[model samples]
Target: MDYKTYKTDDFLFDESFRQWTAGTSPEATAFWEQWLTQNPDRVHVVRQAQELVRALNDHYQDDATDARLTSELRRLVRNAAERREAEAADTPSIPLGQRISPWRWASVAAVIILLGFGLWRYGNVNRRVAAESYTHLTKTAQVSLQETVNTSDHVVNILLSDGSAVTLRPKSRLSYPAQFKATTRVVYLDGEAFFDVVKNPAKPFLIYANQTVTKVLGTTFLVRAFESEKNVIVTVRTGRVSVYTQQDFEKAQQSGLRRIQGVILTPNQQMIYNLGDHQLMKALVEKPAAIMPETVSREQVFEDAPVGKVFATIEQTYGVKLLYNDDDLSACLVNLTFTNESLLERLDVVCQTIGASYEVLDGQIVINSKGCK
Candidate 1:
């Protein structure tokens, strides 16, 4: 007979093997006999697989072995006795009772104990998988702001309960509730963040940045409000957003005070608030210069400009630093056109042009123009 190869799914084969080893069913015995005859040369492969199953059963059968093992052993013995009687009817010359070995009886007892333990462990894993499938829900209430800081420059992404995403920029702080309540989705932002909110017409998403509050049904926008800065800036990249003050709402509702209060922003529009005077100004949004062209031309340039102004220009343009010796050259100025040079190289040319010299102290470039025209 040509040997037939059997390809089996690992899980199905393991489960079937476990059931087969527990007792001698006619189906189980037939399968084992066919498998052995097909690959008689590889009989040890079957033994190794069976041994692994037995070891697992032995490990887990420690608890309740007296009750479970005794019951399982009795079932195995009865099955073996029935198999012997069936064999006697087919082969009259072979003595059925004398065919069994002591070792074969021991193997049957071991297999039954293993099968009981395997079933118990399989039940435990299923229960754990079911328990882990449930989603975590939070109670609704007024919760304190939870602040998360990412010291590294990596962008931090968070998913709100309302299915919105907020990406915080580097060196920024954002605070929101552990769970959103019925009224609105409120978040407090300091520094900068990019928001992609989910739309719910009934409940608006409000971002409180310093004195100004930005409200929207759903929109994508960027907000920057540094602590020392006098203005809170909101730039809308897409969708619509409304900007107004807390006082603006109160004033608009007054019986006698009837000035138009809220500012609705369209795409590519920005709102700036003067923190000192509580004035809100709307302007067509211009891309920030740092993100714009490297070489922005000026019609006319100033010669020997104030050191402070020069440092500010360098910081804004190439996002670099300039340190100055306060006592030596705080009032010193340089004459230069910063057209298309790397930041450090530009600083070098500026120092040379003004007959001044500079040295890098820490990450900042310090200028010392003590005695120069």
Candidate 2:
């Protein structure tokens, strides 16, 4: 609504509005907060501008930067408001309360602070904030794609139009929509990334990386699929994720994927697809941890309990499949207490007590031991 009236710089420099949005001034915050509530149409604009300011503040934490920006923003907002008033002199002035609604001064503080800085710099936050201007400028209704290439050595954070956040690893390339398609949120990656997706059940979030197609709904996960690497791996940090071959998903469109074609991974689980053989292997992550409920005490101790029961508890806590033969280890009893040690550490202790060892095979733990006589 009349976005052309204020340039990007105007929003960034407006000190009065920035104070409200930043909650630095209580009086200003209250007035602007109420004003924004009444102006739903302007919410997106305000949010974008706010994101820009936050990005700058995060990058440049100097007090001088804020002062210079505040001065520039003040000048811009004042000049623009004056010009608007002069143009509308003939019209009756709106009440002070009503004036704030039409032009939410609160969100009018974003501008081109990053004029040449670069794109989405928020640290690995999948904001999924609406970039209306970027999306609106596209000519065709076809997929409006935007590529974020992290040529630098450090990780680059990017925000998608659908509000999803992508943390692109160094030397990685990610192509995503400026605005999502109505049915699915799709992104293509050539290297590695950590994604925190915004959930929309109607539209699934899909990542097409290397030879894999990962599907999720509002989850955080990591995908590593370098061009030179032999395997494309998808690891779940939180929430469930489905991994399948791009070829398989495309082929199974008519009748849906066969049960064996895809793998669903829960937290601390990983799905690896070999590029050469196209074989998918599911397993636990390298450093597994106990995923107990909040109510369960983390410092549970075992006294005179069978070692099998201890291993079983580990399996259930971390959602891992411990492959020790129950029959072989049924006689191994142990008395130990597990406190804050990680799952791996706990396992080491248990195995030492029973004089056995373990190895991981395809995400399952295989125990090697003669029966503890």
Q: Following a full C-alpha superposition, what root-mean-square deviation does model 1 have from the true structure? A: 23.1
Candidate 1 local lDDT, 1-373, one digit each (tens):
2222321112113445555665437687677678778678656545644674456555544233444544544565456556656875887574667775644644554455456546765685445323222111111224655666656688899788899898988887777887887988987776788899999888989886665678899988888876557888887766788888745543554756655476777555678887655677776454322323444453225486876677676656633345665555555676666565555566677677656877644224567776443
Work out how many backbone clashes candidate 2 has.
Answer: 14
Question: TM-scores of all models?
Answer: 0.37, 0.52
Query: Would you list the clashing residue pairs of candidate 1?
Result: none
Candidate 2 global lDDT: 0.73
* Count of backbone collisions within predicted model 1: 0
C-alpha lDDT of residue 345 in model 2: 87
